[model samples]
Target: MSDKYAVPNKLPAKQVNVMTHRKRRLREEESHHRVKRLNRSFKLRSKKRDYKKPEFFITQYLKAERDSKRMRRVIMKNNFLKGVDDEEPKLLVVMHHRAHRVASKECTLIMNSMGLNRLHNTVLLKNTTESLALLKMIEPYVVYGYPTIQTVRDLIFKHGFLRIKGKRTAINSNKLIEEHLGEHGCICIEDIVHDLFTVSDNFKNVRSLLLPFSLKAPRDGWSKKIGVSYSRGGEYGNRKHEINALIERCL
Candidate 1:
């Protein structure tokens, strides 16, 4: 009875080998699953790192390139169109208002409606009959003129911005212009220049879509007397083509 219970405690060698093999297989399976989990976690971490990469420098470089090309095209176009329309009288007008001095309520209302609520704030508009009437109504508080092609080009290229969702967004890329004004055939800055310069049918849309330009007081400074007309050497009223010189100095 004792032998039956205790003498057979050691198993056969074949049985022992089979048990050892089964334990090794279980350990190998656990190691394989752990390796797979570690690889998946590493891949997820790499994706997050890729998403964090900064694009600021690339954007700035692209902007610089676009500006350079646009400037060259503007220069060529201006050269070709020069002298041909010197006397044709451009309808593209530049306007700025003197807000320091008191103005009549009627004049103030007109100026504000035209978005000339601040001093040295500039706006470009097509010289239509209605616009002419508005200008005359607030003539005493504003200075206006027929800007040259160069003036218009410089203003839009250097200081131009788009009115996007009621915000003043700078014209950094043609992509941005296309995104907003594509339907009007204004997919790039060049299209804007053409529309504004030619006073095309889409001029109203293009002009209205622009943010009002805020310019520095001309480097030459303004006259102390804001009440007099520009022709008489004061700051207010129209200067006609002479406005180009004033804007250039400010630029």
Candidate 2:
């Protein structure tokens, strides 16, 4: 938390490098696995720990695949819009998690090239926070971050998920509403999914999480600051750089 991110006051970097840290972690994990396998094969290890396929691990892998499908779907719908042949296509942005500025800008630039506009249509958010993961902050999203139904179940059942930034996020709603809801059973069916189709390229499940989406837009100044004007200066500058780079690459 101490080491904050400052966007270096220049044209923003691209998203291609956002996962560098995560990729390093993955490589480390792979190395560890290889060493473990070698030890088991050679005489260096005494106890032969049999590779038991745990159902929990299986569940997590499935969850990641599911989330990825959902993500791609969200991306296609919001960003690479399907219906319009003539008009500018809307871009869908699937933020797997809290992406850094460079990643966000690169994603926006990519969508624009695919005939979609970042200022409209794209949606970026953490899928697991509120429902899919249904647990705590999901620190594993980076390296230790492993997504699974079992891990989520543990978070909800073991930890009651009472604090803010848990598996899900509650927007600027009344605290009294939360307290009262906590005291009693309630039902809030966010109906937008049914009304409007949302495909998740990551998860592949199109849940109706519309109320928050609708509510969040106006609150996020969507109604007022839309079109090209809504693009923030820093993000826009980065988008410009990314676009030029993309064009140069194509050439």
Candidate 2 Cα lDDT to native = 0.31
Please name the candidate that would achieve the greatest lDDT relative to the true structure: 1
Candidate 1 to native Cα RMSD, angstroms: 20.6
Clash number for each model: 0, 33
Span of 10 residues, lowest total lDDT, candidate 2: 135-144
What's the true lDDT of residue 233 in model 2?
28
Question: How many angstroms is residue 155 displaced in model 1 relative to the true structure, after the best TM-score fit?
Answer: 1.2
Model 2: residues with Cα > 4 Å off, grouped in runs: 1-151, 158-160, 163-179, 182-251
Compose the digit string of candidate 2's lDDT tens values, residues 1-251. 34367445554456546567779989999999999899877864676667756985676566656545655565555432323333321222221122222122334454333223322222222322232221111111211122233322222222221223333443334352334342332121121121122222411221222111110121222222121211352212113123222222211
Kindly list the per-residue Cα lDDT of model 1 for residues 192-230, writing each as its tens digit: 888888888888898778877778877866745766776
Please, what is the whole-model Cα lDDT of each candidate in the order they appear? Answer: 0.73, 0.31
- What is candidate 2's CA lDDT for residue 200? 29
The alpha-carbon lDDT assigned to residue 79 of candidate 1 equals 37
